[model samples]
Target: MSLVDLSWRNVRRNFRLYTIYFISMLVGVVIYFTFSSLMYNEDVVTAIQNKDNYGKIIFIASIIVFLFIVFFILYANSFFMKQRKKEFGMYLLYGMKERQVATMVFFETLFLSAISVSSGILIGGFLSKFFGMVLMNLMNYNDDISFAFPQEAIISTILLFTLLIGIITIQSYLNVRRVQLVELFHAKEKMDKPLKFSMPFAILSILLIVMSYYTITIAGDTNIWNDYFKEALIATTVSLIVGTYLFFRQFSGWVLQKMSQSKNYFKGNKMLWVSSLRFSIRGNTVNFTFNSLISAIVIFAVGFIAVDYAMKGEVVKKEFPNHFAFSTQDDETQKHIDKMMNESHPIIGHETITGIQTEKISNRKTFFSYPEYYTEEFYLFPESQLNAIVDLRGVGEKVDVEGVEAIVLTRGIDEPTKYESHQPEITVLDDNTFHVVEKIRYPLLSIPTNPGGDTGPQPSVLVISDEAFEHVKENRTLSSFEIYQIKDPKTSNDVSRKIYDIVMKTEGAYYSAYIDMYSIDTESSSLILFSVAFFAVIALFALGSVIYFKQLREATEEREHYAILRKIGVGDKEIKRIIRKQLLFVFLPPLILGLLHSWYLLYYTVILVIKDLPSLTTIIFSVMGLYVLTYLIFYVSSTSIYYKIINEKNRR
Candidate 1:
C-alpha cells in the first residue's frame, strides 16, 4: 500500500485511542476560530462599544488561544510517537526503510490535523454568531446586531492551525528518525525515574504558597501604593505557580513513604497496591506534578471566575447606587437628561423606579476609625435624606439618633463598619463631633464633589440627625445631587449610555455622571464574562481529554502486570476492586489538592473584596460540583480501559 493509504488505515484502526487527542485539537481550533470571528464581527464590536479596545483584547486573546493549541498538539504528538514505536519497529523489521517509516508518520499527522482543523473551523463559524448574540444580550445591549459569515476569520484560523499541523508533522518525522529497533520494542519499560523528596523544599513551598496568599489579600482596592500593585500581583502569581509545582512533586513521594511506614496502609489490598505502584508512581512523577498544577489552575479559574461573575452585579449595585446621577438640575440640562432618559428607556427595556434629590449641606468631611486603619470621606446630607436614599438596616434595634448621635454607612459585609464589628465615630468637616450611635452596612453614593486624583477623597456619606445637621450647616452653600434609579436594568444599557452622553457633552457642567450597575456590564464586565468562558473551555479541555492520553499511555506499559495478577487466581471482582482503588489514587490527589488550593485562594480573595456576598460562595461550590462531574467521566473511562487492556488472557 502507498504511504498515505497505510497512514489512513492506522488512524482508522486506532481511532478510539486517538479520540481524546483529536477532540482536544478540535476544541482548540474551535475556540481560536470563535474568538477570531468575534474580533472581526462588526455588529458585536459596534454594539458592545469600546470598539478599538475590544478589538485589541480579542486579537490578543486569539493569539493566546493559538499558542495553547500549538502546545497541546505538540504534547499529544510526543505521546503518539511513543505508543506507535512498537508498530514502527515492526514495520522496520519487515524491511520497510527508515525513510518510509518517517513518510508514514508525516502522512498520519497531516491527515489527522487537516480533518480536525477543518472540522473545528466549520463548527466555530456557527458558534461565533451565537456567542456574539449571547454576549450582547448579557450586557443588555439594545442595538440591532446582525450576524454575517466572517471570511477573514475563517482564512486566519485555517492558516494558523495549518501552520501548527505542519510543525507537528515535521516533529513526527523527527521522532521517527531517532528511533532504533531496540527502542521501538522495549523503550517504555526501561523507565527508572527516582522519587527525590526534599524536606527543605517542601517546607519552602508551603511558605511561598502562604506568601502568595498574603500578597494577594493585601494588594487589593484599598492598597496605599497603587503603582506597585502590579508588582505584588506578579509576585503572587509566580509564587503560587512555583509553590504548587514543588508541593505536588513532594506530595506524591511523601504519601508513598508515609503509607509504607503506617500500619493502616500495610494491610490487605493497601500493601499490595502501594508496594506494586511505588516504581510506577516514581516514573510518573512529572506527569502527576503537572496534573496537580494544571488542576489547581483549572480549579482557581473555574472557581473565581464564577465568583467574580456572581459578585460583579452586587458590587456594581453597591459602588454605584444610582442608575444615573447629575450634580446640576438645570431646567435645560434636566430637560436634556429627562429627554435622553425617557427616549432610550424603551431601548434599554427599563422604567424609572425612583429619583432621589439631595442638597449637600456643604462639603462635610467624615472620619471613622478601627484599630490601625482609619478611613476619611466627605459628604453632605441630613440623616433623613441619607436614610431615605439608602436602606440602612442595622444588625441591632434601629434607634433614631435623637440629638448629637450619628449613624455611619459602609458597603460590604466584610466592612470594618459593620455594627457588630466597628465603633466608628464621625467628625464632620473637622469641627462638628457626633458620637456615633449606630452603623449600617448599606448602599451609598459614589460620585465625589471634587473628583480628583487617585489619592483624592473616597468619602462615605454620614447621616446625622436634623438637629446636628442644622447646627453643623452654619448657613453654607451646599452642592447637590439628583440620582435616578431604574428597574429591569438588563434592558437599560441604552438609557444609561444616553444619560452619560448628555452629561459628558457639557463635561464641566456636571460633577460626575455614571449609570450605576448596568453601565459596567456593557463595557468592563463583558470582557470579564468572555474571559471566564474562555478559561473554562481550557479547563474542561484539559480535564476531559488530557487525562485520557496519560491513562492510555500508562495502561499500555502496565498490561503485563494485570495479566500476571489475573493468572495468580485473582477474580474479575477483586481485580476490579483493585482497579477502583488505583484509579482513586490517581484521580483524588489532584482533585483534593486542587480543591484546597482554590478554596484557600478564593476564601482569602472573597474576604478581601466581597466581605458578605454569600452568593459568591454558592456560585463557586456550584461550579466545582459541575467540574467534578466532568472529571468523574475521565476517572470512569480510565478505569474501564485499564481493566480492559490488562485483563488479556494468559496463553502460556
Candidate 2:
C-alpha cells in the first residue's frame, strides 16, 4: 500500500482513539480563541483605554495555551506510540525496515494533526462569537458588539499546532528507532514500583505545609513590614508548593498503604480508588506540582476580586461625598442651593461652604517629623461629646499664657488650620494676642473615607471656635455655598435638578449642584460588577488550565493500564467507571483545598478592603455556591474526556 493509503486506513481503523485526542485539541483551540476574542473586544478595549495592553495579554495567553498544547501533544504522542508498539514490532517481523515503520508513524501523526487542527479551528471560530457575547454581558457593555473571526488568530493557532506536531513526530521517530522489537512488543507490561522515600522527607513535607500556612496568615499583619512579609510569604508559598508535590509523591502512597491496611479499604471501591490515586500521584509529580500552584493562583485571584468588589462601594462613597457635586466653593451657587432645598424637601441639616489652609508656624525642619495636629481617633467624637469635654474643663475665661496661643481645637476638620502653639514661657514676636485654651474633641460627619495617604481616604480634622476663626483671617476666604442635608438622600437629586433650573433663571448664579446617593450607588455597582467578573475570569482560567493538564497527564498514564485491563477481560464499561472514579479523586483534593484557601483569604482580604466585613455566613455561602458550581462543571467535563479516551483505547 502507498504510505498515504496505509496512514488513512490506520486512522479509519483507530478513528475512536483519534477522536478523543481530537476533542482535546479542539477544546484547547476553543479556549484560546474565546479568551483572545475577549482580550481584543472593542468595549473592553475602550474600558481599559489600553489596546496595546490587550495585545500583550493575547500574546501571553497564546504562549500559555501553546505550551499546554505542546505538552499535551508530546504526552499523547508518547502514549499512542507505546500503544501501537506491538503493531510496529509485527511490521518489523514481516521484514519491513524500522525506517519504513517510522515513516508510517510519521504519516499517521500528520494525518491526525491535519484532521484535528482543521476541525478545531472551525469549532473555535463558532465558539469565539458566543464567548464574545458572554464577555460583553459580563462587562455590562450597552454598546453593540459584533463578533468577527480573527483570521490572524486562526493562522497563528494553526502554525503553533503544526510546529508542535512536527516536534512530536520527530521525537516519536527517534523513540521508535531506539527501542528493540522485543521491548516494543512488551511495552504494555507494568514496570517495577518506584522506591519509597525516607521518613525525613515526610517530616519535611509537614513542616513546609505548616510554614506556608504560617507565612500566608502573617503576611498581611500590620506588625510585619510590607516588604519583609511579602518576600517571606512568597518564599514560604513556593516552598510549600514544592513540598506538597513531594509529599504527594512519597507520602501519599504511605498514607494509602495505611488506609488499605484497615477495614475501610473494602468500602466503596476504596481499594480501586486508592490504587488509581496512588498510581496517579506517583506517576505525575510535575503535573501535581503545577496543579497545586495553579490552584493557589486561582484562589488568590478570587480572593482579590471579591475584596475589590466589596471595597468599590466604600471607595465611590468616599471619593464623591454627594452624587452630583464632589466639592463646591462658588458663592453664587449658595442662594440657588437654598431655593432648591426649600422647594424640594425638609432639610435635616445645613452648613455653609467652609475651608482652611495651614502653614507651618513652628519652623519644623522636616514635614513628617512634625507632631500630628489631629489624629483620626480623636476626631471621631461627636459634638455632644466635645461639648461635654468643654463643660468638664470648666474654663470660664481663656487662660493667658506667654508665648503660647490658647486655642480650643475642634475635632473633625477636613483640612488643616493654621495656628501657632504657644508655651507659657515663650513670647510672640508679632502683636498677635494668644490665649491657652483646652483642645476639645468633637465629631464631624465622618464620611466613608480612607486615611492611609493616597492609597485610600483620610479623615478630616477641624479646629473651630468663633475667637480662633476671627484671628486666622490672614489669607482665608469667607465660607460660601450652603449644604442642606436632606431627610432622604434620594431627595438630593430632585433638589439638584431644581437648583440647576433656579441657577439658570437667576443671573450670575453660575454653578448650582446637588449630590444624591443614587449616583454614587450606581457607580459603585458598576465597579463591583466589573471587578467580580474580571477576577472570576482569571480564576477560571487558572483553575481550568491546571485541571486540563492534570487530566491530560493522568489519562496518558492510564492508557496502557486500561489496555492491559481490557486484555484481561475487564469490560469497557468497568474500565470507564474506574477512570471516572480516578478523576474524582484527582479533582476533589485541589477543589477542596482551593475553596478553603479562597474562603480564608477572602475573609481577611475583604476585612482589609471593606471597613465592615460581611458576616461569616454570608461570605461562606457565597464562596461555597460559586465554588461548587464551578467545580461540578469542571469535574464533569474533565472526566467525560477521560472516559472517552479509555473507551477509545478499549475499542481499539
Candidate 3:
C-alpha cells in the first residue's frame, strides 16, 4: 500500500486513542472561529457605539486566542508522538525508511486537521447566531440578530488554523526523525526517579504560600497601598508561583512518603493506588502544579468577570444617580436642553439642584484611616432640597438634619468620600461647628469632583438644615445644576448627543448622560463577558482533556502491571475500586487548590469593587460549580477509559 493509504489505515485503527485529541482540536477551532466571526460581524459592529475601541480589544484578544490554539495543538502533537513511538518503531523494523515514516506521520496529522477544521467551522457557523443573541442580550439591546457567516471570519479561521496545523505537522515530523529505534521500542519503559522528601523544602513551600496570601490581604491597607502596592503585588505573584511549584515538588512527595510509612498503607486497595501514586509522583508533580495554576486562573477570571457583568447596572446607577445631570445650566440653556430632550424622550422628573461649594469643612475621616489626596470642597446642600431630590428619584431615604447637625453623602460605595466611613463634628468657616448626624452612601449628583488634575475639588456633599446653611452662606455664591430623569433613558442616545454638544459649548459646564455612559459601558461589559467566558470554557476543557489523555497514556504503559495483578486473583471490582481511588488523587488536589486561590483573589479585588452587588455569592458559587462539574465529567470519563485499557484481554 502507498504511504498515504498506510497513514489513513493507521488513523482508522487508532481512532479510539485519537478521540480526545480530535475533540480538543475541534473545541479549539470552534472557540477561535466564534470569536473571529464576532469581531467581523457587521451587525455587531453597527450596534456597538464604540467600534474602534471594541475592534482593538477584540483584535488583541483574537491574537491571544490564536497563540493559545497553537500551543494546545503543539502540546497535543507531543503527546501523540509519545503514544505512537512503538508503532513507528515496528514500521521501521519492517524496513520502512525513516523519511517514509516521517512522511506518513505528517499525512496522519493532515487528515485529522482537515476533519477538525471543517467540522469546527461548520459547528461555529451554526452557533454564531446564538452567541450573537447572547451578546446583544447582555448589552441590553433589543434588535434582532440575523445569521450570516462573515467571509472575513471564515478566511481568518481557515488561514490561522492552517498555519497552526502546519506548525504541528512539522513538529511531529521532527519528532519522528529524531527518534532512535531502541528509544522508540522502550519509550514506555522510561520512568521518573522516585522523589525524596526534604523537611526544609516542605516547610519553605508552606511559608511562601502563606506569605503570598498574607501580602495580598494587607495590600489593601492604606499605608501599604500607598508605599508598597507595586512591590506587594509583584511579591505576591512571584511567591505564589514558586510556592505552588514547591508544594507539588516537595510537600506532596512528603505526604505520600508519610502515607507509605503508615500502618494503613497496606489497607485494602490502598496499597494498589498509593504505591502506584508514589511511583509516579515525581513525574506527575510538574503536571499537577501546572494544572493547579491554570485552574486557579480560570476560576478567578470567570468569577470576577461574571460578577462585573452581573453588577454592571447597579454599579452604573450608583456612580451616576441622575439620568441626565449637568452643572452651570442657565435659563436659556435649560430651555434649549428641555426642547431637545423632550423631542426624543419625555422627562419623568426635573430638579434644579442649588448648592454651595465651600472649602471650610474640616476633620474628614475615611474608612482606610488615611487622609485623602484631593482638596476638600464640600458641596453643601440644605436638607430640604436634598430630601426633595431624593424623593423625586424615589430611591434613597430622606434625612432630617437638626440644629448643629449635618449629613454627608458620598459619590458611591466604591468612590468613598474623605469623611465617608465616620461621622465627626466639623467646624465650617473655622468657627461654626456642625455635628455629623448621619452618612449616606449615594452620589445624589454627578459632580465633576476630580477631573484628573491637581486642582479640581473632590466630589463630596454635606446636607445641613436650612438655618445652618443660611448661616454658612453669609457671603458665598451658590452653584446650580440641572438634573432630569427621563423615560427610557437607555434609548435616548441621539438626544443625549445633542445635549452633550450644547453642554460642551457652555464654559465651566459638564454633563453626564445616561445613554452616553450606558451604551459604552454595556457594550464594553458584554464584549468582556463574551471574550472571557469563551476563554474560561476553552481553558477548562482543554486542560481537562490534557489530563484525561495523560492518564490514558499511564494506563497504556501499566497495562501489563494490571494483568499481573489480575493473574494474582485481584477481582474486577477491586481493580475498579483501585482505579477510582487513583484517579481521585490525580484530580482533586489541583481543583481544591484552584478554588481556594480564586476565592482569595475575588474577596480581595472584585468584592471591594462591587460590594453592594446583588447575589454576589450565588454568582461566585455558580462559576465554581461549573468548573467542578467539568472536572467531574473528565474524571469519570478518564476512570472508565483507564479501567478498560488496563483490563482488556490480550489478542493476537
Best by lDDT: 3
lDDT of 3 by residue, 376-480 (tens): 667778988888888878888787777888877765443444444655776666677777766667666653421111123335677899998888888888888
In model 3, which range of ten residues has the least summed lDDT?
449-458
Q: Tell me, by TM-score, which candidate is best.
A: 3
By lDDT, the better pick of 1 and 3 is: 3
What C-alpha root-mean-square deviation, in Å, does candidate 1 show against the real structure? 7.2
What's model 1's lDDT at 150?
A: 83
Could you arrange the candidates by TM-score from highest to lowest?
3, 1, 2
| Of candidates 3 and 2, the better by lDDT | 3
lDDT of each: 0.65, 0.54, 0.79
Choose 1 or 3, whichever is better by TM-score. Answer: 3
lDDT assessment of candidate 2: 0.54
* Clashes found in each candidate (C-alpha, N, C closer than 3 A): 3, 17, 0
For candidate 1, the TM-score is 0.73
Q: Write candidate 1's Cα lDDT for 1-652 as tens digits.
A: 8998998998898886577567767877888888788887888876654566677777777777777667777777787788878888899899998888878877776777788778987888788888887777666666665555588898897788778867877787788778779887887677556465777877777888888767766655455337776777788878877876776666556666678779787466676566555656655555655666676666677667666665676666665555555555557877777666666552222221111123333322233333112123345456666545544211123336767666666545324343435544555555666666655654345533221111213345566677766767666656565656544545655555455556556554333323433444445666766766676666556654566677677777777877877778777888788878877777777666666666667666664567677777677787667667767888898889877766543443
What TM-scores do the predictions have? 0.73, 0.62, 0.81
